[model samples]
Target: MFGDDWLWMAVQWSPPYGERAGFDTSTTVMLLVTALVKAAFLWLILRAPLPGPLDRRARALRRLLYLAVAYALVLWYPIGLLPDAVDTASQLALWAAIDVLYLLVIRWRSRVLRAAAAALFAVELAGVADQLLDDLNLRQVHWGEVVGLGWMVGGAAATVLTVVGQWRDGRWSRGTLVAGWASLGVYALVITLNLLAGHLFSGGPAVSVIMDAAGLVTTVWLAATARELPTENSVPDLPPARLRAIRVAVATVTVLPIIAMIHPEQAARLTYTGWSTDCYDRPSFGDLKPAQRDAVFLCVARGMDGGGPPMFPESMSDQAILAYGRALCRAKDRDEQEAILTRAGSARPSWGVNPWDLVYVCPEIIGATHPELLRSAEETQAANDAYIAEENAKCRDPWPRTKGVVQATAKYFLFVDGDPGYLVHDPGDQAAEEEADKLYSGDGLVTVGRNSALVGHIEDVSDLCLTVKAFRTAPPRRTAGWQQVEEVPIVSRTGRLTVPEMGEDEVGAGAPMPNLAIKGKGRYRLRVYVRIDDGGEEQHLVVVFPGASRKKLTLKP
Candidate 1:
């Protein structure tokens, strides 16, 4: 089960619908191009002329040729889309099919070896068949799990015999090497090597394409260096008509897999996956009706295997929900938008996303809890600008602008900005509060004083902010802003951002935040706005340096 889960995790290299990591259209296009080249190369190898008629190996070569041809065509664009639910089962079937092919080429002389190979073949075939039916709503795929032990036992036995039998024959035949190399390709494709290698390689469609390239190259080797087998003393036979008939048989089956292309069945519509999300490039969800919108999104989400890791921090769940919510918010109007966001509240475990735009859908929640969003976007921006001006006048420092991956229908980039008081000097007070709300107390960011440890890994850094809890007093008023003082500057870059090297002593000297990595030696100062829960607002400027006075604020867990 962990193998399945890890393979699923390893294969998620594609960015969400709209990501800001500069992973753009060109990279995706190149991925598609690689797959096509692999498919074409495989087709060429599969269609290579069979061993000469005088060769006793011709029968086996012809069968392998036919099988490989069918497999390549199906494994390409159209037919390979079976087991079509677009989940783990579908992925398993694709990889399992390759295993079946590897088992096929093992020359079993003993009855025991043949039986083991046959058993492995039968179980995998049944598993793959049940998967297709499972997607069609005809049956569940429980039997595959039940038979998997027998499947592995049979597979291992076949592999051992194949190797030992080849060793007994003195030299390794080119055919045997080709089959072994292709089997290794199958192993590499399904993550057998990656798991042992500790996930050093990246995944997604590109990895699968690499495996197919291996298969094509191995097939070429198989054909060019085919082993010389026993032949009859009689002259080479097979008349012109018979040779033409064999060619026709190969060509006919080669083209038969195209039926899936002509009538791809429901998998084309039902199975939306990472490989095919942009295949048709459907218009915005706002362009569809209620029923159509849900249908499209559900299919696409299933395809992409959306949902949180089984046991993960709340931040992971929140991001998955945010990405999906951003996609769903593309509704035609306020009425449709309400239908989508309202699910977060009604759904069993709440989505836990901030009610930033929920004002349009659930204003009651905001009016009672998140009063910050009561203001409009323009009002929030103006307030941020005014505060930035004050800081500039007093400290002669420009407010730092942080960027984020913006969705196509996003109103503005700060979907949920963390506290501007953290590493990022974000000017927006409301955005800062919402972003901080997710991280301030979560495993992602928990700050302590100079004597304590840091929270979160380097992955916590985003374009807009590095979510962190500063070892300073919680702002008394509705808003506050913080930045490294002129002396102990936190970063090394001027315009572009870069992580600074933090030594043990320096880290213990200033802020207790994990990502601070303070760069300078001398002390520093920062301005803040604060108000008591029951009283009027006030302003204060605090200094920071080695052995500076630090206050640890309690954050919500």
Candidate 2:
């Protein structure tokens, strides 16, 4: 007898549901119903009279009873009370036991039955291999459904051969063969359709209904076509003691190799993969209904390519981070957008931009608690600043305008650290408050600053302003405006003035600028705007260098 509380936990941990309360309840009910049906089948088989010796019928009856007991023990009882690791081992052991018994039955019959048994074993072995290799990648294994399909196919084939052999010996009736074949054909078609539609057992209620119908039909046909051997031709049956000994021997012989072959490390790896929320996470969009959850799980398992280590921070649960990141991308907030990309990093990056326009655009949209994005942004900004510094050093007079241009370009190109102020404000404010609160409380402010600052900020004042000015450049113009455009000190051979022009061209042929002066040493500022569009709606602030001389300067917006 099982306690109700233990029974609930047992149901919670078992196959087909795995700790989901509603699914556990439904599966519990299903197992109970299946157990009852199997019990009834055994009772009916026992009640049917034996045409040969009592001992032969008794042995057959015991075999059916043993199968029923095994089903009840494994599927209906508290076997899942074991730890998940142990439960999996137990389940495999149970399958081995059943397979051995089935093989034994075939061995007891004849050479033909032995050959059929070998074929069935081969199919089962192939199925197991399929489960381990192909189905692991597909993430679509349903052991119950797979076993059911095999049973329907294998049982039908065996029954057909038996009927044919009997008919050859003049021991079969037309009605029995017709009924068996008819039932098999219908069941096979239904199962085939179910599998094709990706329903199978995982479809829940609808597939359960089909399974019930198939079971009922098969049971009825088997009952109607039940036959017994003649007394004179009956094979000698084993006594209960001998049968039990054989059962023990067969169970040991069959189960030991499988048990030994089981790699705990491999099983642990697979168990973690299947149950961990990393590879499969809930959807952030649409209804959060059960169906949607299932769809998301299936989609993530099947849709995403390159199953590698997760990109999100380990502190955040894989499922939560993935869901939030996906939602953030959809919302398209610039900060959140950058955060997602930063979090994805070089290793995994994104599959591409989300097509759905759900737009989760705030930094807070990343589950608020996950600051991995912020941390990553800080690191990126520091790296970008260093790269820009290194690049600026290569330039002649790398200060003010040149330095600012390099910084701006670096920031835009790298696009990692986010807006400049993002890194400093949060920690700076927190530190200030902590110091103030400690001083006011007479606890003495705890000094917490390192020789090297954690935050990254621009060092040079001119570079800072220049970078700002570059960022504030007007929107792109429709066409080049000659009137508003300033003649550059350097010009192309075609008479067009190009800013920071690399090639040699005379100053007289180029366009010009106003308030243009090259500051001593490493600084320059030109207070002129060049209209680069016909609409004259947009312009560029042209900052010139020493060698640059102008023809004409114009300022326009």
Candidate 3:
């Protein structure tokens, strides 16, 4: 009947408020007080001599209805009232109504009461299922989830026992009774573990677990007593005056808190006797329409002074806009500037006027007044773009590489300087010079120096044939398969450059080489295209021509 309030007690902490982390003292006090009231009320119903000659088990079951009304105030305040989520608030209302009905008639053997119990059980099962699935999907488990799972197990067990007893005319089968006792047994074990952990006093999580254990223990006791209730036809007879009193009591506890939850403003006046520090203290946008823009600015200034981030007002003075831009310019880094701008932009409606547009309109003034700032910003953007382009050319692109079957291993490299390994057989003095000719000689699909192309195959795949093609300018980009294109500047002193390898390399002293070379020792542009086919064979194509300056341009990191 208390629903997820038991689970909330298990996790005892409020949602973070800006920089404030931990439970709200007011909320904790409210929980403790309501719990005490529930205990006292239950004690009275069990021990005190009341007007009605109520069955002990039946009265225990009925008391849950009143307890539900009391706890709704405690649950609704933090979960829905504070957030102002209308849908969440509506859901809580629906849940409370169903729970109240279930508790009110759970002792009577009626189809309506059985249906209510089933519905309540369904809700609890659904919640537990969601939590279970969420935990399964999450990569890392948190301590809160562990505690929550423990609570779910206990709650589900109690719900199963209660709902089953209702369906079976308030009598538990032997097996069901065992399961109920087992669930309580587990709850006891968990309580023992919590005590052994030695944090039963102060910490939020520890205290909450102890509190939730107490709640579940109460539920188990109540559910156990409910099992002894007389069948549907044997319900205790109560006087009309007792019924009216019960109704009045439940309504008084339920309605007033609901009204408070609905209109928290009036509720605040009764309870909170302090100055309001909320955003509502400032004039709303509609109220500021007739007022000068200074009013909006001053309101925003006060909000910022309270350690809140700045926000864009509906209307901003040119001076204010300039000040914002200058502040961004003064930021230590681009990330900080973007963060400030993002917060300001997020505060305004999308269809409304943008603050940056106003600043951009007078770029000349910004550039002149903040010369070192704006001009450097442009340079910074250019550098950023250049860095992005350079990063895009990096060969370390991760797989899964654009949908293709791995047929043969093939990779291509562009050497601005001729292949470093061409004439370089390692270490010894005569070693490199002796093998230079054979290595440099245009052999099959391989070449040595002077833009000599050499293709190396994956280990034993040296005989694997690859197709090579070249374009005078540029080819239409390959839409399918993995591809990379980079514009490389070539400074050719002799003007002659070799085309990349296409076919297999025959390791022989003299092999007919392709007579593909651009004739010019001047500055030229080489656009290299490396592509991979579905069969995993690599294709290389270089567009060699005279274009772009040969001067080396170094990009900043």
* Total clashes for model 2: 11
Per-model lDDT: 0.37, 0.37, 0.41
Using TM-score as the measure, the top candidate is: 2
Error at 105, model 1, angstroms? 10
Model 3, position 4, has a per-residue lDDT of 42
RMSD of each: 23.8, 19.3, 21.2
Model 1 lDDT tens row, 375-443: 655666667556534532432111223211210100011112342223332212344334434444644
> What's the TM-score of every candidate structure?
0.28, 0.31, 0.25
Model 1 clash number: 7
In model 2, the runs with Cα more than 4 Å from the true position are 1-47, 53-117, 125-170, 174-179, 182-226, 231-482, 485-522, 531-543, 546-557
C-alpha-based local distance difference test score of model 3? 0.41
- lDDT for position 133 in model 3: 46
Query: Which of the two candidates, 1 or 2, achieves a greater lDDT against the reference?
Result: 2
Candidate 3: residue pairs that collide: 109-232, 407-535, 440-448, 495-520, 495-521
